[model samples]
Target chain A: MSRQLIIKGSLRRARFTLDLDLDVDLSKPLGILGATGAGKTTLLRVIAGLERDFSGRVEFCGEVWHDGDHFDRVPTHQRGLGVVFQDGRLLPGRTVESNLAFAQQRARNVNAAVSYEALTEALDLNHLLSEPAEVLSGGERQRVALARALLARPRLLLLDEPLAANDADHRQQLIGYLAEWLPAEGIPLVYVSHAAHELAQLTRQLIVLERGSVTAQGETHVLLEAQSEAIDSVARPVAAVVMSTDVEHSTATLQLDDDVAEAVLPGERVLLQRELTEDSGLGPALQPQSDENEG
Target chain B: MSGDLQAVWLTALLAATTTLLLVPLASPLAWWLARSTSPSRSVIEAVVAMPLVLPPTVLGFYLLVMLNPESAVGSLWIELTGDSLTFSFSGLVIASIIYSLPFMVQPLQAAFRAVPESVLEAAATLGAPPRDRWLNVVLPMAKRGYLTGCVLTFAHTVGEFGVVLMMGGNIPGETRVLSIAIYEHVETLNYDAAHVLALGLLGFSFLSLWLVYRYAGHRFEVVRG
Candidate 1:
C-alpha cells in the first residue's frame, strides 16, 4: 500500500535543463499532461532509468534507485518498468507472439493480478500472434506492445502518448479498453499525454508540465480548468450532467448549463455511469458543492 | 595435374578457415563500427578498412615482416606451436583473413547500422543483456549482412594472390594455393593448365557473386552506410 514515488533531479543538457522535485502517490494512475518540449517523455525516461545523464535521487516503493552522485544507479533493464513508447517500438524481425514471448521469458516476477492469458485475450492478440511485428497496423502494434509490456510484469507501467499514433477510431477503442482494464489490473501507471480528454478517460489526478517544470498538480477537472484554458486556444473545458441514458440505443442525454444535448456513441451510457457513480470505487471523487473547488 | 588439384583443395581450405575465423572476429568489430560514438571509432574503422585501401603488396610486406621468426608475433607463435609462422597453411590463413578483412566487415557493419535503436532499446527493457540483444535481435535483423560478409570473405580469400604470394611462399601442400599454382603454370609456359585454373576461378567467382547480388545484395544497395 505504500506506493510512493519521490523524484528530485536536475537534468542538464547543452540547451535545456529540467529541474524537478516531485512526490507522487502511485497507488492510483497518475496522468502527465504536457505539450511538446514540456519534458513529459524525459520525465518518464528518467523514472524508467533510460535517461541517466541527470543528477537525482529517486525512491519508489521505499527503495532508493538513484542517490544523486554516490549511488550506482540501477540500469534500465533491472528497473522493472514497463514502458510503452509512443512509437510502439516493437521488434521488427520477431513475430508478434515472439515479441510477447520475449517479454514473458524475461519476466522476473509474475504478478498474479496480470496473467499472460488474460492480457493476450484482453488485447485481442490471439489471431495476430503469427504475423511479423513490422506488418501489423498502427493500432494492432500498440496493442501488442501494451500486451508485451504487461507480460513483463513490471512494477510500474509508463505509457508515453500510446494512442497518439493511432487513428481516431482506434484511439477511442484503445482508450475505452484501457479505461475498463487499468483499474482492474492494480498496477500503478504514469500515463503521459498531450490531450486532456484522453488522460481524463484513464485517471482523474494529473500533473501539468510546462517547459520542463510542473505548473500544476492536482485533480484533473480543477487543474485543467485553470492550466489548460491558458494554453489551449481552440478547445475549452465543458461541465455537464448526464440527464438520461439509452442502453439499447447506445446514447446519452446531457444537461449542460440548461442546454440539452443528445449524443450517440458506443458504450456512452456505461462510460457516463462509471464516471458519475461513486459506488464503482474507481471513479474520482466529484463534489460540486465546494465554492472554491480548488486543486 | 595432381599438384593443381592439391592447390585447389588448399585454396578451399584457406578460404574456409579465413571465413570461419573472420565471422566471429569481425562481428564485434562490425557492431562497434556501426554503433559506437567514441572518439576512437573513426580510427578503428580506418584500421579495419586499411586492407581495402592499401595495395595488397604493402599489406603482404608488413605481414611477412611481422611473421618473421624474430618478430614478436612470430616468436609468440614459435613459443606456442614450435613452428614458423611463414610459408605455412597457418600463415596463409592469417594472411587471407587480413586481406579479406574489409569484405567481411563493411557489409556486416552496414547491416548492423541499419538496425533501429528503438528495437534494441525495447530488447534492453525486456531484460536482455547487450550480448543477448545482439545475438537475438540484431543478428537476426541483419541476417543479410552476415550472409553477404561470409560470401564475400570466402570469395575474396579464394581469389587473393598478392598477400598469399608474399607472406606464404609456394611451399607444396603448405602454402601453395590455387592462385600461386596458376602463376607457376603461366611462368612455366603451361598455358593449357593455366587456362583451366583461371577459367575455374572466374566461373566460381561470377556464380557466387551473381547469386549474392541477385538475392541479398538488393537489401544492401538501398540501405548502406
Candidate 2:
C-alpha cells in the first residue's frame, strides 16, 4: 500500500495561528524546516493527534486519524505513531530501562527491523539503563527518548529536533544511523528540525514553514542549496551554538566558536553551515552560523 | 469494653471501605478536575470541594433527606437489597465517601496534574491506549499523590462525627465509630475510657499527617518540552 499523509487544518492561538493544507507522499522521508515559533512543533503535534483544538481532517494511508469535528477523531494513542519530542519527556520517577520497557510492552506486533540489544548499543544507552530518567543529561535524555520511541514499533515516526541536545560527534553519528535505519525499517518519517543540514542529510522532500505558512516545498538538497547561496551572497556568517532558546520572546543565546556569546532575536538570519571534517563518513557537522540584521 | 472495641473495629472498617471505594470513584473525577478546560470545570470543582468547607451536619442532613427509605434512591436501595439506606451501615459508607471526598480528590488531582500532559502525550504516541497510559504512565508517577490522598481520606473518615451522628445515629456495630464512641464516653462521664480513645485518635491523626508531609513533600518534577 502506498503511504499517504494528508493534513488540512487551522489552529488559532491568541498571538499566532497555524493554517495548513498539505498532501505528502511517504515513499521517501519528509522534513519540516522552520525557525522558532514557526509552527513546526505544532504541526507535528497535529499529526500525532495531540492538538485537540485543531479543526480539520488528517488522513494517513487511507485511515482517518482526525476529522473536522472534535468528537470524530482517533485519539493520540491509536494513531500508531512514534514521536521523539524535543525535550525527551521520559517517564519521571522511573529508571531508563523501565521507560524503554514501557514502550516495548505496548509496541505493535510488527516485524521490527531494530532489535532491543542493537538499539540499546547503537544509542549507547546500556550504561544508563539503571539510572533514573530525571538525572540524565539533556543529550542522554534525548537518546533514551529516541530508543523508547523506536521500541514502540510505530508505523509512522515523527521526530522534532531529536538530535538537538547531543554534542557534535554524537549528533553526526545519530543522524547517520537514522538515515540508514529508517528506510530499512520501511517506517515513513516526518522529521522536524531548524538545522538545515540535518534535514538535508536525512530527508528527501522538505517543507519550509515561516510564520505558520508553507513558504517553500521541494527536494531537500535543492532548497538547502538555494538557502545557502542566498546566505553566501549577503552576510558574513560566523559559527555559533544555540545555547538556550526563549520561545516566548523569539530569541536564542548563541555561543560562538570565538568564545563570544550573542543573543539573537526573530528575523535575524542564522544559517547552519555543514562543515565536512576529516571524519567525513560520520556525516556533515552542523555549525549554526548567523548573520545579524535588524528586523 | 466490648462495645468500645466494636466501635473501634467499625471505624477502621468504615475508613478502609471509604478509602478503597474512593480510589476508583475519585480517580476519574480527580483526573477530570485536573485536566478539563471546560467552563463548568470550576463549578464541578467547587461542588467536589463542598464537603471540605460545609458543616458536616448540613451534608448529613441532605443525605438523610435524600436517601431516606421514602426517597427515590433509598427506595431503590430498599428494593435492591431489602434494607434501609438511612441509619444503616451502607448509609454511613455513603456519607463517609461524601464527607471525605476532598481529602481523596484534592491529593489525586494534584498528583494527576503533576503527570505532565507532555509525558502522557509521549506515552500515547508509543501505542499506549488511554487506559494503559492512565495505569502505567499516570498512576506510577502520581504515586505520592495516591499515598497522600489515601492516608488523608482514611484519616479524615476516621475523624467523622457530625455526619455519622446525623446519618447513622450511633448504631453500635453498624455505625457508632470512634468519634461517636468518644462522644458517648464523654456524655456518660466516662473520662478514663474517653481519654484512651481520644489519645489514640490524636496519635493516629498526627502520624497520618506526618507521613504525608515527610514522604510527599517534594512534588514529582518532569522534564518539560
Candidate 3:
C-alpha cells in the first residue's frame, strides 16, 4: 500500500505566493491544520492540478505527475484525484443521484470500494435522490459532497473545511463517521482545518501551514501532547486531551470510544467506557464517562 | 386584411430564420465574451458590439460591399457556396444575424457569466471535459440567458428595415420584409395598411415574448443576470 503523494510547489496569487513542501504518504488520513489565508486550499488546488502557474514536482504512488525542471505539469482533469471544496459545490441543477453518478463517470483511476448505494445509505440520502441539489440542507449537501468524492474512487481525497457548514451535532456525527469509514476503507485523505480541536479526533498526522510554508509536520497525537517551537511560532496551545469531556458542565455522561477506559467522574473524564450498566442499550450507547485521575 | 396577414407571416419567417443563425454562432462568441480573460477579450467584445454603435446604413453598406464577390471575404464565401450574399433571403438572414449579434450576446454572456466558477470546477473534478462541462453544466445553468438571446435576436430581426433596405434592396418576397412593406405603405400615404402592419408587429412581439418568459420561474426575475 505505497499510495503516497509528494508535492513541492509555489503558486502566485495576486499579492501572495503559496509555497508548499510536503510529503503525504497514503497510509492514514492526513490533516493540514491552519488558520484562514494559510494557503491551505491553494495547496489542495495544486494537488488537484487546478492551478497551473505552479512550479514543482508531484509524485503519487510512485508516478510522477509534475516535474518542474522539464516544464511538465499535468492538467487538473488528468490528475486522477478527488477534491471537496469548502463551499460544498454541489451541482444545483442536478439530482443527488446524478451528482454521485457524475463522479463515478470521472474516477477512472479509483478502485470502487464504496458503492453509490452504500454511500446513500451511510449518508442517509435515499430520499434526496430525486430532489435538486439546491434544495438540500447544509448538512445534507456536505454529506452528499463527501459521498460524491468517495464514489469517484480517488487515490487521494482532498477535503477543505467540510465541517464548517455543520452544526455541533452534525459535526460530532460526521467526525465519528469519518473516523470509522476512512480508516476501514484505507482511503487516504488530506483534510484541511483551522481548528486543531476538530482534527484531533480524526487522525494523528498533523501538518501546520503558516504564511505560505510548512512550519511543522508530525503525528496529531504527538503534536497535541506537546507544543513544538515551529507550531508555537504561529499558534498558541489549544486545550485538548487524548479523551476528555466537560461532563461536569452538565453532569451528563456519554460513551465516545473504547480502547482502555474506566468510568469517569464529571471533571477529569478521559475515554468513555461501554458500561453504564443501565437496563436499556441506550444507557451504554449514551452513557457518560467519569474519571478521577490523569498524567 | 389578406395583405396584412401576408406581411405578418413574412416578418415571422424572417424572425425565425434570424434566430436559427444566431444559436451556433452566438454560443461560441458569447462564451468568449463572458469567460476569456485573454488580451483579446476586449477586442472580441468590441467587435461583437460594433453594430450597436455604427449607423445601420454604414453597417449595411460595409456588409453589401463585403458580400459583393469582389471583396476577399465575399469571394471566398461565394466560391465556397456558389451563391453570392446579395438580395437573397439567405443574404437577409446573414445581414440580420450580424445586426442582431450584440442583442443575442449581451444577454447570453451575462447568463454565462452568472454561472459560478465553483460549479465548473466541481464538474471538472468529477471528470467532465471542457466540452462536456459546457454542454452539461454551463448550458443548463444559463438557460435563461440563452432564451433571452433567442427572443431578442428574433425581435431585432423582425424590426430590421434599414439594413434590409441597404443590403437586401427590398425585392418582394425575397427581401421586402414586413418592416419594408410598412415603409412602402407610409411612402404611398397608405396609413391604414401601415397602421395594420405596425399593430401586427407589436402584437406578435408581445405575444411571442410572453409565451417565452411568462411562465418562467418567478425565481428567475430577481436572480437573473
- What is each predicted model's overall lDDT from 0 to 1? 0.79, 0.84, 0.74
The candidates, ranked best first by lDDT, are 2, 1, 3
Ten-residue segment with the worst summed lDDT in candidate 2 chain B? B216-225
**Whole-model lDDT for model 2 versus the true structure?**
0.84
Q: After superposition, how far is residue A95 of candidate 3 from its true place, in Å?
A: 3.5
Kindly list the per-residue Cα lDDT of model 3 for residues A177-288, writing each as its tens digit: 7788787667778889754556778776888788778888989878754543333343422222224543323223333344333232211122122112211122322322
TM-score of chain B of each: 0.93, 0.95, 0.87
Per-residue error at B96 for model 1, in Å? 1.7
TM-score of each: 0.84, 0.87, 0.81
**What would the per-residue lDDT of candidate 2 be over residues B160-180, giving only the tens digit for each residue?**
999999999988789899999
Off-target runs (Cα >4 Å) in candidate 3 are A69-72, A105-113, A228-295, B1-10, B211-225
Ten-residue segment with the worst summed lDDT in candidate 1 chain B? B216-225
The candidate that achieves the highest TM-score relative to the unseen native structure = 2
Candidate 2 residue-wise lDDT at A165: 81
DockQ values, each candidate: 0.26, 0.49, 0.30
TM-score of 2: 0.87
Per-residue error for A87 in candidate 2, Å, reads 0.4
**Candidate 2 segments whose C-alpha is farther than 4 A from its true place:** A236-295, B218-225
- Residue-wise C-alpha lDDT for candidate 1, range A177-286, written one tens digit per residue: 77877777777889998656677778778998888888889987777666533333333335655566554444456566778766543323223323233212212221
